[model samples]
Target: MAARVDVKLAELGISLPRPMQPIANYVPYVVTGNLVVVSGQVPAIDGKIAVTGKVSWSVSVDQGKEAARLCFINVLVHLKAACGGDLDRVRRVVRLGGFIASPSEFTQQALVMNGASDLAVAVFGEAGRHARTTIGVPSLPADAAVEVEGMFEIE
Candidate 1:
């Protein structure tokens, strides 16, 4: 486990919760060979969507970005649990794909995704940095403000 991750998480007042199971057909994560694919996780906690609605419309861009941060936290929780709660087991983050619910006019998807990308680096240092994409969409399940999925290289 990396001490920097713990330090950053504490500094940010962030706590990773228990890993959650999928609500429907798909699994939360699937590990194939050295790659781990985490399903899209919304801004949820305790089986409830933490934030809902479209960015810059029903929700502010900042709020939506925070929601994106939470989704990334959830992804890390799942990853840690799968690897026996040891971040050292993760070699690196491969890709981060983010989906934001926003109006047609919203163009701050990249800025919103900074929350996730920033957190990843803060946690895993260089290994946490990865290729990423931020996409806008009409709506998401549970009407979540943001959703994020990830791929990681594991040891």
Candidate 2:
């Protein structure tokens, strides 16, 4: 039998990417009590960053959105590990923090972040509604266009 969330992922045509090992010393996720804090995830597919450069500068808004969604998919990969490989253990998506590589003049970080937020709702329904903070940063690790970190409440 598949986990309920696993079925949902299949229905959404989302195959959770293979887990990536941390490049630095920090762990990918920390589970303390009922909360799982996922580390920042870059838009890497098959271990290679899919998008790079600054939004509204070298990267277009639509591309940035795709990068954001990819980052969230990586976040989900880690979150599943934190939940013992069962996404159905998730109770709610408490929060998500999005960091976008952008110039100081760029002001559409929120719109770019919608990529991740929309997918969250699609996967988790109402439980995915979360508080979010979107920031336009000068750069992100590996020059990735987007980075996403999340806090999830799990059963």
Candidate 3:
């Protein structure tokens, strides 16, 4: 079956752009056996970071959440590409890692990360849920307020 990710995206009125090329020296994704590991995805849209700076100081929590959502969308794009656009090839979402550029005192990492987690479940049903880590970071590439990475098990 083809990936339903695109359909869900269309339901949201979103169209995932082609996965962006890696910046710096790292590859964007790697497949090991049945597992596909996607590199950290910034909140970039159309090759540009949509928002920058630390949350609370320069960006709001809501904005960070939006960024997290975008990151997940990008992840799905890569997943679809890796599996030939067949989401049914996915067996499980093994894990997700999220980094939020925020003040050291901020304690809402879990909430911010949920933005992506919820979206995953929305698209893949129960298979979308996974082990996750949300951490507050001092900074990130392009000074993006949020970045998310994903891992999936393919059938």
Candidate 4:
């Protein structure tokens, strides 16, 4: 049987890709005590950047939202690994940090970040409601439209 979170993802028509390997010197996730800290994830599908460039410039707001969503899915991938492939071990989504690549005038980072936030709630239900910080950045690695990192409490 699938885990409840996996079922939820399937219901949403999302099939998580293989977790992306860290491109730099950091591990994908680190478990300390009962917490799992996921390194920032970019919008990637099948090991390729799915979305790139800045929002409100090369990427539309809607596309940016989708990018954010993909980033969150990647976060989940790492989280699942940290939990030993059992998402059921997750207790709560502690926090999410969002970075939106956007122009200096772009002020809708929160709205764009909702893509990830909404998916989190849908996947984890009440436990998904989490504190978040979203900010616009001038650029990101690989020019990804959005990046997300998370902290999760696990059993």
TM-score per candidate: 0.92, 0.97, 0.94, 0.98
lDDT of 2 by residue, 33-68 (tens): 999999999999999999999999889999999999
Q: Is candidate 1 or candidate 3 better by TM-score?
A: 3
Model 3 per-residue lDDT at 108? 85
All candidates' lDDT scores?
0.87, 0.95, 0.86, 0.94
Give the TM-score ranking, best first.
Answer: 4, 2, 3, 1
Off by over 4 Å in 4: none
Tens-place lDDT digits, model 4, residues 1-155: 77898898899998878988889999999999999999999999999999999999989889999999999999999999999989999999999999999999999999999999999999999999999999999999988899999999999
Clashing pairs in 3: 3-87
After superposition on all C-alphas, the RMSD of every candidate to the true structure, in Å, is 1.8, 0.8, 1.5, 0.7
Cα deviation at 109, candidate 2, in Å, is 0.3
Count of backbone clashes, every candidate in sequence:
0, 0, 1, 0
Ten residues in sequence with the least summed lDDT for candidate 2: 16-25
Candidate 2 local lDDT, residue 151: 98
